[model samples]
Target: MRKVIVNNIVSLDGCYADATGNPLALNMDAAFDQANLDSISAADVVLLGRDSFDGFSSYWPFIADAPEPDDPDAPEARALSEVNRAISRRYNAIPKVVVSDRGGVPSDNAWAQTTTVVPRGAAASWVADAKRNGDGDIVIFGSRRMWNGLLGDGLIDELHLMVSPTVLGDGVRLFGVPADLDRIECRRYDGSPNVQLRYRVLAPRSDRAS
Candidate 1:
């Protein structure tokens, strides 16, 4: 069976989005490093909640064309530009399954394609079927509610969280509550701007006792 990975970037205080609901508070250079690209590229299928789907679909497609080499910011922006280009290409090419209650596929005017919509209630079944008959690992990014459901359903396999150094006093948390987990690994990249915590979700306490 394929493994389901929940990968997200959050602030040090454990907030995924800020007071204004913006999820872009982290330092870009630290957030989109080589390790981030590797994790994203490892998956063949990307899973997204409605908000995540909307956010990514609106952006990544134009990333490759952005960033002017001659611009002043270019000196400091070049490395990240290349990384975003690579990630954008991979993100745009991979098939996506969006879990949403709303209807209709968003218009495919750009690189967005091979998209499938699964209603909210059926997300677990969809994920299970995909895991049974799919290829490569399934990855979900920046989808809090979806992650909550998956966590409760015991469908998530690996959880990767990139915690930034800044602390937001108020915001939406990546995980509403602490969960019992077995640490697979913890990586702190250079500069220590962010740390990636990887954990394997263990069976529920009840299940472990049986």
Candidate 2:
């Protein structure tokens, strides 16, 4: 069975995006590392809510299309940028399912061939069925509303949270008010600027005895 992994880059203060709904503070530079690369590359499908779908569809496809500006003083940075470009290519190739309650269809854009738009109420069943028969992992990125719904349905199998070192005093928060005490199954800190956390959600608060 395939697993649904909710992967997010959150700030130290627990915000997923800045006050203006930008994810600029997420220093995802280190994610080019092997461990992180493997996690992202393993996804055969990506699940996204409207916000994330719009954001990613506008951004990730052409992220590596331009030439990198030369900076002789920053050789390491230049090399890392190339690595990131390659990673972006791999990511763009994965199939994506965008949950949009509004009637939307894949566009004629180059990247749209791999995308599918599903209505909100129908997405839950599609995701659950995918888990039962899909070939690889289904990754969900930065879709809070979709996350809440899936979590409530007990459809998410793992959460790969990438916590950045910086703090955002205020912004749009991810993982809003919890309905229960979710359990952490495992935790690992890469020897880098960010920490990755993995958690397993237990049953709802009312279902658990004190």
Candidate 3:
């Protein structure tokens, strides 16, 4: 079966919410941006929680052509425009599995073409089915709640974390495990401004002994 990877940007204190008072500034790390785009490029489907979807829907679409925060003709502005365009196209084209309890249909637009709202309890099975359908690895982004649920159920195969330097006293934590995580193999990448950590889930001790 294809792997289900969870990719998220987190603060040193583990908060995933808006840290700089601006929602767009949540997990604002250049390294994380590049890494997230790379993950999206590799995955066949992107999974998101309802809350994350709402946030992304409002931000990513219009940002592409929006006026630059700084100089419009500057290199940074051009780069932002290009990245936003790429993000918009990729998000619109890739299949999206949104986990929600609402049981309603996605909106009638590009969101409809690529989006499906799976019931909360059925998310793991739906994700497994998608992976078994010959789709490449499914990448789940944002949605700390979803991450916690999937992690607890042992549905997540790998975790790609972009650890930022800043810290928030309290906010949305990415890892909300109640018990200790089973054995994990971690590989660290020296991605400056933000460190990248890749963890492969290992079999539980009891399973390994058998």
Candidate 4:
């Protein structure tokens, strides 16, 4: 079966975004570009919630190429630019699935050819069918509610929380329900001011409403 991975970058206070729905709204030094690149690279199918898909489809498609670094001598800037380019390529090419209660995506969408929107009512069945039909991993980047429901349905295989060291006093917190998970790994990046907590779901609340 294709493994389903749900990944999110959160603040020190456990919030995924500020009240305005912007992850960097509060000037939080969320410099985890490499992590984002890694996620996109490992995904064969990118799963996103309606809001996340909206935000991503609006922005990521525009990241076709990175701007030249202001200072050519600045390796860090140049490296970041390359990362952006790589993420753009993968994110745009990989097949995408959006779990939304809404109807469907417009045909003019840049990702329309590679995107599929599953109604909220059919998400579980769709995911199960996708898993059965493939061996590649289905990765969800920041669909908290979607992942939450999938977790309760015992569909999620792994949960990765990339925690940044910032405290946004008020935002949409990540955890709203209890889960049964086993620790996979908790590691701090060597040169980055972020840490990742990985977990594998041991048991899911199948009784929880989807």
Which of the numbered candidates is closest to the native, going by highest TM-score?
A: 1
- In model 4, residue pairs whose N, Cα or C atoms come closer than 3 Å (at least 3 residues apart or on different chains), thus clashing, are none
**Tens digit of lDDT per residue, candidate 4, span 1-210?**
888998788888988888887886432222466766776687789999998998888777767665776886775564446677777788889999999988788887878889988999899998889888986889998789888888777788988888887898999878655678899999776667788888998888555532
Per-prediction TM-score: 0.88, 0.81, 0.79, 0.86
What's model 4's lDDT at 111? 87
Better of 1 and 2 by lDDT: 1
Candidate 3 Cα RMSD (Å): 4.7
Instruction: Report the C-alpha lDDT of model 2 over 1-210, residue by residue, as the tens digit.
Output: 988888887898888888998887666655524434566688888888988777767766775785565763584554346556665686688888888886664575556788888888887899889988879888887798797678777777777777788788988888643544345643444566776777765543435432
Candidate 4 has an lDDT of 0.80
RMSD of each: 3.3, 3.6, 4.7, 3.2
Positional deviation of residue 11's Cα in model 2 after best superposition, in angstroms: 2.3
Model 2, position 136, has a per-residue lDDT of 88
Looking at candidate 1, what is the lDDT of residue 130? Answer: 89
Q: Residue 147's C-alpha lDDT in candidate 1?
A: 75
Candidate 3 runs further than 4 Å off: 18-27, 64-70, 73-79, 106-109, 178-192, 203-210
Q: What TM-score would candidate 2 get against the native? A: 0.81
Colliding residue pairs in candidate 3: none
Pairwise lDDT winner, candidates 2 and 3: 2
Q: Which ten residues in a row have the lowest lDDT in candidate 4?
A: 24-33
Model 1 scores a TM of 0.88
lDDT of each: 0.79, 0.72, 0.70, 0.80
lDDT of 3 at 184: 53
